[model samples]
Target: MSNFAESRADLESYISARVPLISIRSIEQDRALRLVREMAANPRRGNLPLWIYTRATGTRDLRTNAPTSDDRSWPGAMDFAATQFANRPQSTVVFVDPDDLSDDNSASRHVAELARLADANAGSIILITDNPLWSGLQRLGMSITLSLPDASEMYDVIHAFLTDHRGVVPIEWNEQDARRAAEFLVGVPEGTAINVLATIVTKGSVQRDDVEHLARFKDKHFGDLAGLERVEVAPDSQQVGGMTSLRAWLDRKHQLMKSDLRGTKLRPPRGVLLVGVPGCGKSLSAKAIAGQWRLPLYRLDLAAMLGQYVGQSEGRLREALDAADRIAPCVLWIDEIEKGLAGQNDSTGVGRRLVGQFLYWLQESRSRVFVVATSNDVRSLPPELLRKGRFDELFFVDLPDSDDRQEIIQLYYQRYVQREPTAELLDKLVGLSDGFAGSDIESALHDVGAELHLNAGAELRPEFVVEAFANTMPLSRTNPEQIDEIRTWGRERAVPAGRPPTSTMSGPQHAGRRVVVLSD
Candidate 1:
């Protein structure tokens, strides 16, 4: 059976059993009310009259669509509901936006009394709201949360929307694109999905390239949520300098990562945890993965999710996760993950709870939100976070080796100097940049470019770069003890990002070698 069918069945069973109070938490009021009408019309349900009460529409008959009374205020509505149940037993009264009961003490008492009266009179009072309010009703009623449309329902929604606008606007999606769009629309409401589709096709025909438009639309949907920021990804052709091993891993999973995965046992890759020394391209890898895979990137700020009120933090976390799920097939990057989650020993235990929630979602979330978390201090991280299943792999991004340094130097040289480096210049810069992080290499090269620019278009020379390197102090030299600790941890626990260092020209013998000034 479909998910909605199963939920409707559950609702029918509850109403048939004459559950005095039924609380449904949902934002889709029309769909929720439709389910109530269907349940009321069930042949076995004895034709129970359906009465819906809203602030604007006081009381209306579901079948006839006619207003029964004009007492629209909260207190007035409660009194009217009590009168309806007492006058006619076994009627279903749905109170829309019943959260107002929590704000008024008299209304709360009135609802509680009405629930008790309905229980005795064989009638039901259903409370419908998006949030779970009125804790006082917990003892008197049962609540069922109606989730947003699932994949199958969303697919139907999209298909129906397309069919409705078939000739009005040009549509160019095949079955596969429709299925992919449905997956992207999983966490979004059906109404919003329709609106987004309408907005997209409103401009012109929606071709395959318009799939990116849907991603941008989903990003807007998540913009209002706290603790999550959407990051724009560069094109897939943008190359990341090093981390050969990590890049190779991504290449292997590239096919499955892009596939829809309908009939295969191959699950999409979860993501990786990059823990390493500072300025070693850990966070850069996170952004690069999104570009490499052609997916959007969103950064989750865990510390920003903490709220002053109880449950608010968890709610915000859930909102962020849901937003990620909605924008699936995207990269979720959490930089410096340890700083956000290392407070497990706090007095209030909020940290512990947050850790539990995050770990649970990390393991159980089926959405294709590939998480790439970077951490500089794994020592502060909880032990459970390092377990194998939390991430597909844990990589150690140490300082760049000789070959990686060469590639990084060349990349930045072309970027900053707008000219290619000669063989001798590349080799000398690589030698001098030994034990330097990727950022350190870029800094020195950037300084060289700035100095050259100041010299009024002077010809680029290797000496300028060498001088810049001499003036710079790499992180390895400044914090030797911490770097040593990180390298030691990585040696045992994590896989190296680049291949092991070779003995050709990376040693100290070449460190001080002066570049030969070859005349061009």
Candidate 2:
């Protein structure tokens, strides 16, 4: 059942069973109030009388907004409620977010006393709060938590809004469009969904394109980002050198990400693990995935999650993971994941605990959070994380080979020089850039482009590009042993990111077994 329906049923049962103290935890106060009001009106619960007490409106009848009491204060309402529970049977009193409930304050103590009086008379006292009630007060009754609406609930809310405003506004959205828009609006509150639709209705027309803007609309509500850093991808930043295998894999997964898997057993595609050389396109591929899939990119900075106190790091990690789940259908990039989770011998057990917590969320969470985790030091990663099913697949991205380097050269050549490189110049540059990472090639071309731009009216020369390449040193050349170690580790375990070189391509092919990527 949806969270809303399940919570409603729980509330009804509590009221029917004469539960004296009932605590509801929810951020949507209005929705919770409406739920209580609706349950009270039902005949199964004998149409019980519900008295709602809000700070703004002291005490009022749930059926009508008319005040049931003259005094408009919390103490006065409590006094009136105590009197009713003492005399009347099956009375339901709801308090809307009264202050001083965090601990055993006077207000909580009074509520606890009132709850015992209600218990004797078989009446129910309901407390609607955004925060958790004190353990002493909460123990007096059962608590039900109402989460944000699911996809099905979102669809109803969106479709209802559109139906209500059909003639008022020009709407070009069909049923499918509404359903698609509802999927995007899944993690938002019901009122926020309506507000977003209203904002769109304010515009002249609600075209089919407006459905795609719903995610950006919901993004505005979560501006703080908690522990995540929003990584913006520009149009030009989407290009990657050459990971034909990874690109093709992501292309297939992108469709699954956008598809509606409501009635099926299939889950959306989990993310991939990119463990390869530094400066090679591991991190860049994260951005490229976000750009290609048209989903917002968020970087989970592990450094920000650490804390000096006990259990602080684990708490922070949970908050970050929960935040990611709330912002679903987005790419979560954890760059150099090993640095954060590779502690095997630390004196404190925080590192091991963090690893366990992360693995639990990754394996069990059904949210559409595509995790693109890259690591330069794979040896330090926990063995359990490397086991099957932790990630969909672990991909090894090595330095660009001759064919990959040629593609990288052409990509940067057009971007910086504003023209394609000649075939002869490309071959020579490709050979010269042997063993260079993708970033190294880009750096060399960027320098050449900057110099050319500074010297206005100067002609673009191949010699200038060659000279720029000559002056640079790549990491692979500086640390050959480290590169070899990474390559040897990946050679047997992970799938190669680049496609197999053909006979026509003139370069030494890296040795690895090619695994075929299958479609569901």
Best by TM-score: 2
Over the full model, what C-alpha lDDT does candidate 1 score relative to the true structure? 0.82
Per-prediction TM-score to the true structure, in the order listed: 0.83, 0.93
Quickly count the clashes in candidate 2.
0
Off by over 4 Å in 2: 501-520
In order, candidate lDDTs are: 0.82, 0.88
Off by over 4 Å in 1: 1-3, 41-46, 69-84, 87-89, 131-136, 230-238, 252-258, 261-268, 302-329, 343-354, 469-471, 477-482, 500-520
For candidate 1, write residues 372-461 as lDDT tens digits: 999999999989999988888999998888888988988888887878889988888888888899899889888888877899757776
lDDT of 2 by residue, 293-369 (tens): 77789999886788999999999999999988888878999998988898787679888999999999999988889
In model 2, the clashing pairs are none
